[model samples]
Target: MIRTKIISTWTILLVCGAQAGILESPNYYHDYAPTFHHYHPQPRPQPHYIHCTPEVHNVIEVIPPPVIVRVVEKRRQTAKDLLDLICRALTDMGGIASEDNPEIGARIIAKLNIEKDTATLIYAEWKDGVNYRSRRFKRQAAGEDRVKNELGDLLTKAGDVIESDKEKLSPAAQDKIDSRHERAVDDCQADVCKSHAAKRNRIKEAKAARKG
Candidate 1:
């Protein structure tokens, strides 16, 4: 009976020791009941960019300047110069305009007036047609000094070309040369008249056409 009691006590002590060891163990729960562990890797950190460079594109354009030129005009000649030119032209044409000439038959009819850049001469002549027709001459030439020089040269040339010494002869000997010069002056006047008349007629006709 005693041996049976001893065996029972020893069994009870063994049971208590096993229960304390389980409570004091570090991995008691894991050792008691093992579970599955699902490990998930952490996401890697992403890099940040500042994007300091701008996308804007600006274009600049430059324009060129303009060029300018200046022009100068010539001065107009004086009226006195024009008047002198007319006298010079008449002299060049070998017609005498001397108011002092005693021989009135050799004198040309001249009307002197001041014009632009030159002188004006109005010459009248009697043309013998069915009756005596009157005509006017317009003489155009340069300035005073130029006209005088040109006319003098022309007169000298005329005297040489005609080969007649009228000034050295008596009045009877100079009759032909003097008459010829007078007739030339008269013819020149007649021509001027015809031209002026034609111009007047043309101008009148143009006016009539414009009116029409």
Candidate 2:
């Protein structure tokens, strides 16, 4: 009977030790349990953007407009012809040639009021040694008109010369001379004389046309 009782006590001690060990175990189950993860998801890598090169295009250059040039024509006149006409008129007047008589060159230079450049001879006349007159002709309209008017006066004097020497010239010679004078008059009227009148008229007309 004593052996039986010792056996029972030893069995009870073993059972209590087993119950305490189960309560102290790490995997013990209860009403609440802590959750744990061994494999964590790695942070999603950031998305990368691909770089692209820009396309190059050729540039066009702009040019400015060109400038326009205008040209103007200038008219110039000289006085040489008027001196010759004057000398011829004087000779036709039947005056004796004298050194004291105005030379064509001197008369032209004197009559011309040109402050610059030389006056070319155009026409000349002399009465005795002191009385002399000359016309410096220009082709300008103003000068041409003056020459035309003066030429008409000269024609009257020329007629007197012919009348005074009517016996010296045959009727045919006088007719011929008269015809020449008439032709000269016609030319002057036509603005074809080597006088300033024609040139001035032409220039005036040209300027008017341009304005129009």
Candidate 3:
């Protein structure tokens, strides 16, 4: 019985010694302990919005107006006016020489109006002879008016042509065309009378010779 009791005491002390050793060891409690983990929350997605507006349009119109035009007529020159211009042109020409003034008279001496029924335009011209040959352009009024004379019409046409062309010439050229030194008039009637007298004398001489 004492041996069994001693053996029991020894077994109890061994068990206590093993328990204390386990407590004092370094890795013994750590190896048998439970583990813990921690986590943080993440941010949520944001809400989105979009705004819209309407489109607008505009329209316009254009217009135009009408136009008008008018024309006017020109008046004709009268006989009296034409005759005055002719007279002025004749006065400007100083003498009568065909070479100096070939288109018209060399010189217009004078215009005579007799009793308002007859008109004579006397001008100097060069004929076949060496000297100036005097001539006349006479016209009787168709009725009572001297302005209706045919000579006036002829002269007026010539004056108009000259006047129109004068615009194209130099002033000096125009002056030369219009004027010359004054000269004497060689009358056509004196020449005609002289010829008649000479013819009569020849006829008398022939009659005398026939009788002999």
Tens digit of per-residue lDDT, candidate 3, span 90-181? 54442322334443332222221121122132211111221323233122222213333343434423333345544445566455644321
Model 3: residue 124 alpha-carbon error in angstroms: 24
Instruction: Evaluate residue 94 in candidate 2 and report its C-alpha lDDT on the 0 to 100 scale.
Output: 28
Higher-scoring candidate on TM-score, 2 or 3: 2
Candidate 2: tens digits of C-alpha lDDT, residues 89-201: 43433232112233432332232223111112122221121222424222233454454445444533444444544335445545554555444333333233444445546
Ranking by lDDT: 2, 1, 3
| lDDT-best of 2 and 3 | 2
RMSD (Cα, Å) of model 1: 32.4
- Per-residue error at 77 for model 1, in Å? 2.9
Residue-level lDDT of model 1, residues 93-114, one tens digit each, is 2333232332431332221112
Clashes of each: 5, 25, 5
lDDT of each: 0.39, 0.42, 0.39
